[model samples]
Target: MTANASRAISWGEASARRMERQFLARPAGRGTRVAEVVAAMLGAHAQVLSAAEVSVGVRAAGVTRADVRAALWDDRSLVKTFGPRGTVHLLPAAELPLWCAALTAIPTGPSPFPPDVRVTEEQAAQIVAAIGEALDGVCLTVEELGQEVVARTGPWAGDLVMPAFQDLWPRWRQVLHRAGQSGALCFGPNRGRKVTYTRPPAFDPGPVPEEAALRELARRYLRAYGPATPQHFAKWLAAPAGWAALLFRELAEAGAVEEVAFEGSGAWVAAGDTEFPGGRVRGVRLLPYFDAYAIAARPRESLFPGEAYRRALAGGQAGNFPVLLVDGVVAGVWHQRRQGRRTTVTVELIGRRLTARQERELGEQVERVGDVLETKAQLVVGKVTVGPHA
Candidate 1:
């Protein structure tokens, strides 16, 4: 049998290695830059802006909320855009082109929009083009974008045909993500409180080919959360299963990836990135809801074993609850409440107990979080009375 079919890798080793790769086994060195951390974590989820800041701040040493904002607005090193699973994310600006190419390469499934209300492929293309022109060198809120698109693409593009947030949205809004996937749009600095969009500033060496982009993206995903199956990748990106399977087949045929036995099932890892950590991961982390590490790790049984499978998960969906990870596995649930300079972090262990040293480590973790957010955090080891997310 080929090494791909015979070599076995266990879940413990996989989880440990993944933790280190995600900068969770330990805080990354002080020199680890914000953009670098964002890239390694496969983009911080930005739906909850403060949570995204905390996600990056807690992982890399010396990275603060100010640092993340500076990298986003000042350095222009990071770009806020629609990313994996069609969620808002903060991706490294330099990789935007490849991200667009790779994401668009995925075979999209049927639209959720009703047939009569949906934009045809041609209409979506027109809206995407109009969005590019409208956002070029200008920042526009959703309302502003809608008006400019109507001017450019006619009344059909401005019809209130799509449903959103218990109300109707413009037909062209359906293609908002398409604009992001085409590298024609991204989030700009917020105006007071409203989110704005802009076309990224031009840079040398434009987007790579779709095939090359998809291949490189697969490799990057494996590097960050490797030994993963096509199903895992598909679920992570909300892509069609058949498409991801074919992509993996193409990768294997090209000798770019190798199949391996993970736990009991078969999985693939990038050919050059099969190395596992030599020791167990030792630490406790309070990962915010939608944190990349909490969302991307596989073998849900192992990572969320026992009570965690019941408590930390929300109706079987991961990343909806702030997880308390012990030695890289979810051991409890936590919630945080911020008031001015002081934040109260509440913990509720479901199945396991931390040793005295682990408790001390948890205290240090709280302090470290305070430093990152520039707040004072108090840790409470009791019932988490607050609701799920902070």
Candidate 2:
């Protein structure tokens, strides 16, 4: 049988099972950050969270900077986790080599740059050097650092310079990676707040075999977000769709992964037996803006429906509500407003008929937020509604 056909899982069942397992495995005390939990959840959803939905997920998951910091240490797990699309993410540090391997060709090619955006090697070098010098001993914001590079490069810095910088961000990230390697940049104050860059400690600058990297990436992708189609992985990784298919083929042949069928959809899962939690799910979480649960799945409709998905994912769009997930499905949207010592949580559902238990659960969640934020929370429930003003 084809690999994809061999390892598929029912999406909802897997999601529910994974969520239960995670909540139960939550580390005690201030040990693991909510970010790590969120990462694990998304990894369970499969290794990619969308750049758009991450913030919400993080907040809802109650992950903080501290949690994210702790999780970045697994080199193969973390570095490649972020920066897949000029946006940042938390990846398993051990999987970086694989992600970098898969993406190396994309960043190096001519197509990554539009025709209007011209950045010659010399200009790039100058910008890099200026940035390196300016950030050598100080931690500056992007705007501050960019201005310095702009002043040094003059008009030749190009019109699409910011995009170019974004394009070259990974290369620049490598500089920080180098710094991290030399111990020049370790995890600063708050999960890399003090460090000039957000990347974790770097690896030795040595050649990594391309095949091995690809294999590892494929394996991680499957392990974390298995029962997923190759298309799903491609979308999550922001890689060319064909690349995902090829990689899956290579890994499956190596006996690193298998396929499963879930709810009529086909996906791949990790090779070994997986365990999950057995319990009824209940909770109304207010996810942070960049939480992993929302971002990891591509096409989003795989989890959320069509128009709802569009409104949420589209950029320059507002009023896409913060989601309230009930039983692993989007039940309503929530919003939080902070006023001095009080935080008001507003819930607008697609339906007003929430079970009494669901309402109580939601109230408790709001209270939990209040406790965490050290503010009194006012919970307001409203009807199902959508609009720019809603």
Q: Tell me, by lDDT, which candidate is best.
A: 1
The residue ranges of model 1 lying beyond 4 angstroms of the native Cα positions read 1-7, 388-390
The candidate maximizing TM-score is: 1
Candidate 2 TM-score to native:
0.68
Task: Compose the digit string of candidate 2's lDDT tens values, residues 87-155.
Answer: 344544543444455544332334455544545656555655666566564556654555666676675
TM-score of each: 0.96, 0.68
Local distance difference test scores for all models: 0.87, 0.50
The residue-level lDDT of candidate 1 at 377 comes to 95
Model 1 residue-pair collision total: 0
RMSD per model, one decimal: 2.1, 6.9
Scanning candidate 1 in windows of ten residues, the lowest lDDT window is 1-10
